[model samples]
Target: MTAFVLVSGPFTGGEVWREVAARLEESGAEVYPATLTGLGERREAGGPDTGLETHIEDVVRLIDGVEGTELVIVGHDYGIHPVLGAADRRPERIARIVYLDAGLPQDGDAAVQLVPDEEVRRRLLDPADRDGGTGWIDPPAADGWQRWGSTAGLSEEALARLTGLASPQPSATFTQPLRLSGALATVPTSGIFCTESGMSIAKLEGLMTLGMPQFKALADPRVSFFDLDTGHWPMLSRPDELAELLLGAAAGEGHRLAAAPAQELPGYLRPFVLDVPEQTRERIGRVDLYLPADPDGAGAAGANPADAAGANPVDAAGANLAGAAGAAGAADTAAAPRPAVLFVHGGPVPETVRPTPRDWTTYVGYGRYAASQGVIGATLDHRLHSLADYPLAAADVAEAVELLRADPRVDGDRIALWFFSGGGPLSADWLSAPPSWLRCLAVTYPILAPLPGWQGVDSRFRPVDALAGAGRLPVVLTRVGLEVTEIAATVEEFVAAAEARGTDLQVIDVPHGHHGFDTVDPTDESRAAVEQAVRSVLGHL
Candidate 1:
């Protein structure tokens, strides 16, 4: 029997391939399904912060465990990037390639950008897609999965596992184009486009024509193409037929697959922002700031991508504030002078041009619940340690603080702050030395790496010397069940570390079955507990 390796796309796990695998198995072919870093239970230490190389390693590792020269890579959705890298690295092992209704990656674009149906593709993208240096689209819900993915055959377990997959894909893949040294040409590549009835016919047509012209252009020698009158998910829609097509291609039963039908072009401009360099007065230093206008903003709001009824962030907020304000192109509400919560978003150098209504845990769906809390949420784009000469991300935070204080609505005196992941530590450093008036802090999953090795600075959780002046602030340490299994040993570990340092710390292990407890829509119990945590901190503030 021939051995095949099927790789599932984003928001899915190896189990998603079961139906297809079972079908192939019934037909006498052995199948090994591969899941990427953050897809299924596979969501590991590496996320967007981990790049294309990580994904390549993941596939290679899976390949090493399986013994077969008859290896065929069948990549679906986001899985295509790593599969190419795998084939690029291990051409000898691959017998043939099958792209199951997936986009062909380019040297300079990520999965999201690779698709040509700009308007239709953007229709699914959301404001939660923050720029984490890797150009990642925040992982959306099942609804999002359906937007670009064919989900006909996804199992209950496969769909259930998605809720646990946390962290927006680290953005690097989207920003950094793959550097294919022409390795893809060596493999006999095939694109399988599933033709669905209710599917976006016009959109699929655009994907073939404008979205993937290279596939069409490569009409001759190396690459092969085919179309199926099936749903988005062939494995579920027509698994046996799809399996036969793959096996037949492997056995050379048909000629090179023909290109699917093409349709008219669709208009689009992904809402992305660029980080142009900005220099300080007196030529102090040059820093990059992505003015959060548009990923490619057209000066004004043209149309709301999310439906006015379903999953629209504007409507989700119960008021289309961003929509209305954007529609009128109203000036940004002048920032307040005080009562501010300095928010330093993830990524060392941030391009969080998009905003999420909910916190890290999307337990309750994406809601702007943070802004509604009567706090002046200050989200800033900070340059990373690499970009800054002195490695002072705090400087950028401080400057942003000043900018916020400069606003009439902000109260600089009674400042309360919140930081998630490494942003907490960076927030602490800025609060310790600066002239800004910061009173309380709530840091979630603070990164403690820099403090230990930072020469000339006392980062060993030192007290009394500078930042806090021997005064302790209420600290909340949170950890999800998964983080303990993966990295930290529950939220108590952080609390214990803080206690040993003589710093007061309150720990909450947010009794959620999954990780990323802070994102919105945490399961009912976990979600309520997180809200309680936030409320307790608010009381302290």
Candidate 2:
């Protein structure tokens, strides 16, 4: 037999778990639904002096009194704090810890820090701003319950029952930092994500790919995940399903996320589809320059001069290539300075990947393809190795642009910037204040806005907002039909903003395409789309 302990979130109590508890009891298991101090029937027993420690003690006492050898503690939302604190002190008694639509907190993380609203978090963290200075945070009214979390799938009666049982929570509970002894690190754990709340197993897996330390830690064998297709309050919205999931969690049965492979390249690094004539390559500082071939075949061999002994070219243009058939005519007229296209590869790419984005087949292919069209092509390796590294990445991009302009072989006054994937946001800086020399801007499958939980992203990184000031700059946007929902939403938002601002934007739709369609899909449509976009960009230049 297993004993299940249910801890409710803020303003609610054991009563909120009644539906789920009944289902669990019917399965011949012991159940204990905890009502913390200052909530539900215990509302009158708490005041300003009540803090997180008091609630933690309440759970610790419950754990001590429960008569069972197999114990599973379930924590929901704000209730996770007391549950974690108690579990740390009684790890031996707990067989599993199930996180029910809750935030992952580390040592010294206060509950208020998890609040998304700026004003609410500020008030909760400041004792002086608490309810009448009594150190109490009032619960939301029945009609205002959505402010807490999504109320989807709940009936009118369920909402009334919830509000009727709600009570004020102590401000200290929100402000007090949670401490851990790391005892529960090895305990088997399950995460039940509420999909309606904008969290799901897929999103968690997506986050893991970003190479964040905290998300990477979730690859532990002891951790499993489940998704609930309902709102945050599953007890009221889907009690039977919640009970069954809890049972499965106790049995250590759920989807396990495999740790990222040690040496496998991510999907974005796949080879590009289009086969274009190779151009001569020159290695500059953090940038790879591809120069077109001379008409007289002076430098027709596609080899890097720098690679040969003492063969440094005076200018980036001195390098040469054998132009493709159609491009020869343009190269014949290239005695004047040549226009340039700088391809910015997208990232948050892990620093561990070999031959970074600049060397990857896709980017190298694009650079060579650009050069074959009678223009200089440049690709760079920027430092967007993590979500928080945006500022540094933006600075690296700025520096690369200057380097491209300084090259005597390239026409600095006729340059176009083409951004891909995560590199799309870097275009916001240029769009906000288009320079006279910047002939055009292009993006393909770009992330125009920050995704959920992209903390510390600068406000200036919003491309949709920047469009209002983009003026008459020619903008080319290539959108795929089957992009991830989060990324697709940002693209739609950017398009709408562009239309609203009457910006000179040209949208190229790939109706049957997916993100990274150029490399992954490889159909004729993909090749055609790539060719069309490249032509449109060059036309602007």
Candidate 3:
């Protein structure tokens, strides 16, 4: 049978791919999500550091069967670490490598240097900082992150089990720079962006405060890109769309969007989804394109994912239209440089949607924010048990990382992550994984206490404890309330605890300040706090 392996990101296991895998199988692709050591139910409580190499071995061993089986290696979020190594070791056995909104090693790169979300990098590597080359992990907090977070959609139950499903990813995973011997250089690449276009409070907070970019960028030669309207947890919010995209891409048919024709319809304006260019006919890749409906089907020659939904290409070949008026056309409006802000919404309840695909939210915003002082922003969609996915929201966040990590405009070295409420715990857990190219960790109103009786939350690795003490990467935090007390009360308590813990913590209590006040009202009391958080990160970068 044709072989495909789905790798897990931080705060997640291979089970998250159940639906996606099933869909692929239905379409005739043998798929399996790799269960690495110390992950999921079969974790490694007492083992060596589960660095990138360890996970790579697990994937390599899983596919040790079937001669000449082309391995379609799919990695999500932190899972990108292993996929890169696997690609290096078994490039010939693998037909293609799909990022699934996951990060990939750039030129002569390491997982630590892949994408530049500095904040996220610190969180993932927190464990490594405290531990001495040993395995230390933070528990997944998918529920806490969604609950107290300003997210727009989610059920209470899904919030409860956020951490329970997650295992402590080895601390070495982040510290051990990924050494791909040139895997991606020769493999076919595809990227998919899950956009959570919502008017939720939590999401709005990320948009304004963090200043994450609205649009993402891509410049790799062997890559293809696409965009979908969903949260960080697309599997839950937009599973069918995600499955369709994933399956089509695997078989080489993905979102083949194109620019629509100019007069095909009345005055209509919309953003064209961005993605990589299509390569071979058998390989499908996506990037949003608004191809106006052509009466003569002029632009139909681009690509399609079959009859399900064909790509509409506008007929801009001949006649003079809009800006495409024949012999030489030019003119446009542009903007400036602001730190790349990845607008990460709190949880399932809401998603932080930005304006477009041209900023910080893409590739962790190091290049823009660090050198150019530009901002990259993004929104949230992936969460537990919101629409379809349960206990997989963390993986979705990882997917977002993958999507933005390779953005052409983003400074992979200075990327960071921002979150509050229900997303706080999840963000903390991710931080516990290992260090990435990221530089700092800015958490507002995070969930420090564990969710009791929440079967969904589990912590095989104590990420916070592992990250505790000296040597741990920098962790900047701000809490609006305590884990169990009033929201404002909890924020105060968290701030205090953060200070005592030696973390760069800041908590605010605005009379009318709630969970997402910062995001919705950028000029509100939380503005200074958010600004401080962003600036503090810049210090290290």
Candidate 4:
């Protein structure tokens, strides 16, 4: 018979897993629900000194008392710390380790490091707020339970029971680093993701495609995934389902995510929809300048035939602008410097992505389409390769702008900056102080604010805060209705701030579109929205 050891998250403890444990026991499995040192029934026995080591010892003692060899250890949220530490020490006696809606922590990771909210983390780190010198962290208020994790599917009665049983967590439990001997590296593992809490197997797979080193280990063949439709506390909201899933997890049966396929061009790098005439591409530093075709119509001066033939347009807006520019006298158009749009691609993209963002089809298509419109189009590769590289990335963008303006073909004073994805925050620097030459600023599906737990991000990169200082700079924003919740919240915050300040802002809504809609959702609505936004931006220029 398989033996199951259940571990609870923060605050409430072994009592919280009673329902799930009962179901497991009824199914003929031996179940042990562990309450760590400062929580649940053990709350009175703990004091300020109870920490991660104390908790790990608590779990180790329970494991030592078990009379069987087939053991499955499950940990949820903060409970994973002790579970992992104990499992590492007793690897030979364990069958499998199940991560029950928890983060995958490594050696030396403290529970405090996993707290996502900056303000809450600050309070936890503050010695003055340590429960009046008791060195205990208070449980969240009943009304603020959602801050810990989504309380979806929990009835009023269940919530009240949870709140009433909560106990203050010892400060040392969060601050003490977990130690691991790395003995359980090859142990079978299963991850239970709570979809409603913003984590899903699909999202993890997408993140893995970015080539982030930390996520690569998840692709191990011994690991599997199971997603629950409810929120974080599945033991409370869906005990029956959680119990059955745990059984299957112990048997090493669950969805196995396929390794990310190797491809020449990933989905994000695919060609855009709208088709248009291409132009010459000039490489200067990290920037790629796409100039309009030569006046004599022999095609662009230095254009690569292969790339030009493959170039596609991103939106119909460029065609309209091109027609308007064509109506003017050729001689006059040829003699004058052209207005420019500097396209900034977004990401804390892993430095491992080949060809970089500038070479991606979306930016290339947009650049070529702008050139087709008789305007100078430019794209550049910046150093936004990590969350902590924002300042360096911002500096790279500033330098790129200067280089674009210095080109004689570009009308320096009439340039606009078009930002995308994570690149949206870079606009904060320009918006905080609108330069005389900046005709317009455009952003699409942007991240206007720092995401939760994004450490080392400079505070200056908040576009929502910068709006108050933006004078009359015309801003065009393209937003998607199906955006990720965290990113969508940032966009809403930006819109609210823009409205409050009466900033010259135009919002183009793509009601059914997703982030990177121009490339991903190639629907008519996405195309039209992109066209409208580009036109508004061109009008400002």
Candidate 5:
């Protein structure tokens, strides 16, 4: 059975979580609201002697007494310190930690040290702990509820509820440093950002963009992020929303929000959205660029490849006909242009410009993988639905190719195009008349030939017919064995034509794999095969 342990912030008690607890209990969950020593009912029992360690011990005892196998530990405000300490001590007992408007503490980091605002520390924290003082920190003034983020829309009821139950915090909880055995990192963590407070997704992303070390953990992809439009005390102002978010976190769907994966990009990778000019302003095709940072982590190198005038277009054009090894050797330079791969995603719709979460994750994952292997990964969206027919779809690919070739970080002479599923037939022109700079063409379970229903469109959509003009452009084709016979026949026809025309093509058959194996199965075998496929393309590049 799964149990939840909710810990309240400084100068607050577990009573603050009364409403949220009630909702979770209604869901048949075993919930425990922990009141640390020197706070809530225990205020009179604690004095100067009550330190951070005592608070940690308080939660540790509660966890030990709980009658459950898995635990979802929740911490709010200053309560995060003791909760993290307890989690480090008992990692296996924890299923996940849902932090509510709280700053995370590292192994040797103190609670006070985690606060980014110096004014808050100097005004509230310092005065309370000075010269071995009463070891108690006073609560914020009632008039400053907005600054404290305790009230959502400045409701008198919410403010009265907050100040009514507020108590003095133990000074030791702020001064004492937390110690971790590195077990905390292994545990799955989540966060609920009170957007009405000072912590917005944009602010967090800004910190990540600046590469600030203090905010590193918040940038982790594994830690799901959520936003509540209320103040810091959502339980008091918006209990239903808070309860639903907590329940979602428990169900492991907290990462469903759009802001969840915004910070998933690594520090070494610079991501930007490129708008395709030919499309409508509202529905223009967009391409995402993930350029790898240089070795020294300064920024992206080879971003100004267009500035290098040494590249000869004629030489690259001639290299297309020269066989794989010859073409690869011809483009070699002392300061070679960075290799780039254009990613085209597949979907049921003919033209898909904005990919879904599954598609985005898969593309970004492949992009990062390509960057790790010393190549640029670019994901492009094409006009879908009404304007997604044969010739128009092919035009979208051409525009994306032109954009990649024009990028400063890309070697205009060393580019590869990867098509997935429905996108296979649209790139027939590239396969038919292979370009000198087009190093490799890779497709995974693609619709190589037009289907019977789509024959009303132009004949140029037929990829197998274009194989005669493919010349010697190196190709990597991944076929899923479990695919339907129609698609299988298309793959077979493309392969046979490529062989007959003497086009340099490599075929990889995943007999036990289904379509979108990487996204669906994600097994070790699938991962290894994808890596091998990428390596094969890179080898030809």
Candidate 6:
């Protein structure tokens, strides 16, 4: 069984989590609801001397008092401070940190710094300073309380109990900067976002736009985000749903995702077949759309689901189409169309091994990863080597693009095209005159021009020849510095040409990595590099 330690925010006591904790306990979790010193029943002990360190000590003591190894630390609002601090101190014992409508802070960032809006800060802090100096901060006015409690959907008596039980917070807690030792980053984390929190989401987005530290902390690859429709207090509004999300996270489901369902995300393989008259194969080619979990409609915020397919895209063959197509089709209909990524795999293999849905296993995982990160992901099956050269393959890409653009669940104008390995040559036409439907181009360890294996091919296969006309489309390239591939010289040529043309080309070099590091090496470095590349591509979308 899992042991959950729930920490409440400023002014609120552990009793506020009574409903949520009760539900967790019913589900067989050993729950410990913690009240920080001076903010709950211990209000008399709080003063100017009670800083963030004191609050952290309070939680560390509770964690030490716990009985089990599967410790999950949960923080709500201001409780994030102590919870994160304690988790940093005991990463060995902690299983994960569940941020429940909480503020995430970086090392050396004070609570005040985490608050992105000046008006709101002034509204909360100015009055506190004027009333009681730095020792304690008083609660907000009546209307302020109403607004904060509005989405909680509490009964009159429950609301009264909440308002009446609120206590003054120690001012030092807000001013004290968090001091971390890189320990917090190692722990698995999940965020249960209250969509009704009018301020936090906007603040986070603003930080991300500015490329700040707090934004990076919240957007770490290890963190999973789940949106709840209720306001700041799900304990009072949607306790059962909150409990289920916590339990699901504790069970290691939806562990590292941008957005996931409160309940289990369904396992479905969906294919979006492209109906273009390229006139080649007997069967119509398809780009499998790897979507995230269907919204449970139990206050689930976003429509992001992950997909399933196996093997490297080049090695995917002999897949059973009949067995994979029809399960849970009804469950996938309501997913709102999102920003998508169109994956173009490399390889100029024999015409007999032309692209197929099953052949895109490796790339499909990338698409699935995109869906997990709140974007729609689709992997295409284009013509192979001798089957059709660059120009024809480019046409196949265009047809697939049209298919994606016509789909209701896709943000057509914001789509990205990712070219892997040998598929890079087919991107020349897109780079020369990028369309409005294209957001950016991501090329990884690519064959930018006709190499030894592809010498004397059609003129269209030479991507380097068209770099001067790459327009202004942003291109993120992942370079493998270790392997000496035949395309190395051509890739360098492409880089120089693209730079001279002022193309927005950003190259990330994996110094000790080989070609296809993501699929071949699959080490921690490989995973990190893949995540970085994935993040870069999604940023354009």
User: Largest lDDT belongs to which candidate?
Assistant: 2
Q: TM-scores across all candidates?
A: 0.41, 0.64, 0.42, 0.63, 0.47, 0.45
How far out, in Å, is residue 439 in model 5? 53
Q: Which stretches of candidate 3 lie over 4 Å from their true place?
A: 45-48, 66-68, 107-134, 143-162, 197-222, 255-541
lDDT of each residue in 1-541, candidate 6, tens digit only: 7999999876788898888889999988899998888877888878778889999999999999987576989998778988888888989989989888775565765665333233434443465443345476666543456433334555667667677878887777877778888887679888876766643343344323222122344555667767677777778778889888889878765534233232531111222111111111112134466654445634211322221332213223423322232231233446566787888876554344423433443565676577667676667666654412455567778777766666555666899998877688888888777787788899988878765312224555567777666677889999877544455677898889887778898888887776666655546676778888888988987
Error of 4 at 331 (Å): 33
Output the better candidate (3/4) by TM-score. Answer: 4
In model 5, which runs have C-alpha deviations exceeding 4 angstroms? Answer: 114-120, 123-132, 202-221, 256-541
Candidate 4 stretches with Cα past 4 Å from truth are 41-70, 84-94, 104-110, 113-118, 125-134, 175-187, 195-224, 227-229, 255-261, 268-418, 422-439, 447-472, 478-541
Instruction: Give candidates' CA RMSD values in order.
Output: 19.5, 8.8, 20.0, 9.2, 20.3, 23.0
Tell me how candidate 1 scores on lDDT: 0.49
- Candidate 6 residue 320 Cα shift, in angstroms, is 71
Q: Give the TM-score of candidate 2.
A: 0.64
User: Which tens-of-lDDT digit does each residue in 257-322 have in candidate 4?
Assistant: 666555534546766756655667765556677878767876553243325433433322222322
What tens digits encode model 5's per-residue C-alpha lDDT throughout 305-413? 2111113222212122213212222342334458888878654342223233213555666766777677777665554332124455576667767766755456889
Output the worst ten-in-a-row residue range by lDDT, candidate 5: 275-284
> For model 6, which pairs clash?
291-305, 292-304, 292-305, 292-306, 293-305, 313-362, 316-359, 337-409
Which regions in candidate 1 have their CA more than 4 angstroms from the true location? Answer: 115-139, 150-168, 197-217, 255-541
Considering every candidate listed, which one attains the maximal TM-score?
A: 2
Ranking of models by TM-score = 2, 4, 5, 6, 3, 1
Model 2 C-alpha lDDT per residue in residues 15-113, reported as the tens digit of each score: 999999999999988999999998888988998888988889999999999875768999998899999999999999999999998877667767775
In candidate 1, what residue range of length 10 has the lowest lDDT sum? 279-288
Q: Once model 3 is optimally superposed onto the true structure by TM-score, how far is the C-alpha of residue 323 displaced, in angstroms?
A: 57
lDDT of each: 0.49, 0.81, 0.47, 0.79, 0.68, 0.66
Q: Which stretches of model 6 miss by more than 4 angstroms?
A: 114-120, 123-131, 146-152, 198-221, 255-541
TM-score of 4: 0.63
